[model samples]
Target: MRLSVVDTELCVGCQCCMFACARRSGLGGIASSAITVRSMGGMEKGFKVIVCRACDDPPCARACPTGALTPKPGGGVRLNASKCIGCGRCAQACVLGAVQWDDDVNKPSICIQCGYCVSFCPHGVLAMEDK
Candidate 1:
């Protein structure tokens, strides 16, 4: 089970992981990435990194009228471009705020837990752990 885990105490707010995620989409920009790193509030609070939890029962899928969001082989939902209507329902259904979006394309960008971002975390904040 290769899952993305966060060691928040080790996080240095470098955002290297986030950049790697964007690059995984071959878009060379954060807009295409599924992960998000933002200040929890301010510098004193460090940052809050958001990624899909790979829920056993994903709410985003239940909210999709077109069934565009469906469960992956392991966890999380895979985006079926052909079935998607760009309604933004998946983004709104996520309780963790992990169901990110591509503003230009109007689609949900949930993490596949691929671990690409883990490699870029110089501070050992992100890891691909076998659970």
Candidate 2:
């Protein structure tokens, strides 16, 4: 399963989803989040939610020289932190620009599509669905 953008038009740009993602990692800020919300251009243009689509064949996994990245059953990839050398290869392989970086740890914060952020979204802008 993966997250789907239900409706971008309804987004109010509150960034609750971003905070929720950070909270999932037990972090106080968005630094470790796998999701991001940003303005398309300005506040009036609404926000763009940047998240992993859980690709069927994740490029990030293939780019892992240490085999740190492994694809999930439905979509996306899971990082084996033990194997990750903070190489940042997986982040570079992400074509959709969904792989968020953890500069302190030198790893990409890829989404597992657990829908934690979706629950926090005030507007119905995001949803968890079968691929």
Candidate 3:
């Protein structure tokens, strides 16, 4: 499965999806979320929803020096935190800026495509579909 942005125009910058993503990991705030919602300059310009696009050939995985990131079956990558050296190369490699940083663990927080956040998006901005 993959999490898709159905319509960015429907997004209201509510950040409900981000909260839900973080909550899936038993976190209390957006800092741990794999998804992010940010203003496009200001509220009038709408918002940008940043999440892994599940690239067929992910550059982030290729940028990992320690082999901590391996490509997932469908797309994206699976992170092995124990092998991660906190190099932050993965974040820099993501062209979409989808790879989120976890300051607490000093690791990347990647979307597993579990679709936990889709249900929380009140504006129908997100969806889960088969790859």
Residue 66 in model 1: shift from native, Å?
Answer: 0.4
Q: What tens digits encode model 3's per-residue C-alpha lDDT throughout 3-93?
A: 8898899999999998998898786987789999998999899889988989888999999999999999889899998999999999999
Best by TM-score: 3
| Backbone clashes (count) for model 1 | 0
- Which window of ten consecutive residues has the lowest lDDT sum in model 3? 24-33
lDDT of 2 at 106: 71
Candidate 2 — which residues are off by over 4 angstroms? Answer: none
Candidate 1 per-residue C-alpha lDDT over 1-131 given as tens digits, one digit per residue, 9 for 90 to 100: 55565667677788788779888867676887788878878868877877787877789988999988888766678888889888988888897788888887888777888888887888877777664
Cα RMSD to native, each candidate?
1.5, 1.2, 0.9
Model 1 / residue 62 / CA error / Å: 1.1
Off by over 4 Å in 1: none
TM-score of every candidate relative to the true structure: 0.91, 0.93, 0.96
Better of 1 and 2 by TM-score: 2
Instruction: Please rank every candidate by lDDT, starting with the best.
Output: 3, 2, 1
lDDT of 3 at 81: 88
TM-score of 2: 0.93
Q: Against the true structure, candidate 3 has what lDDT?
A: 0.91
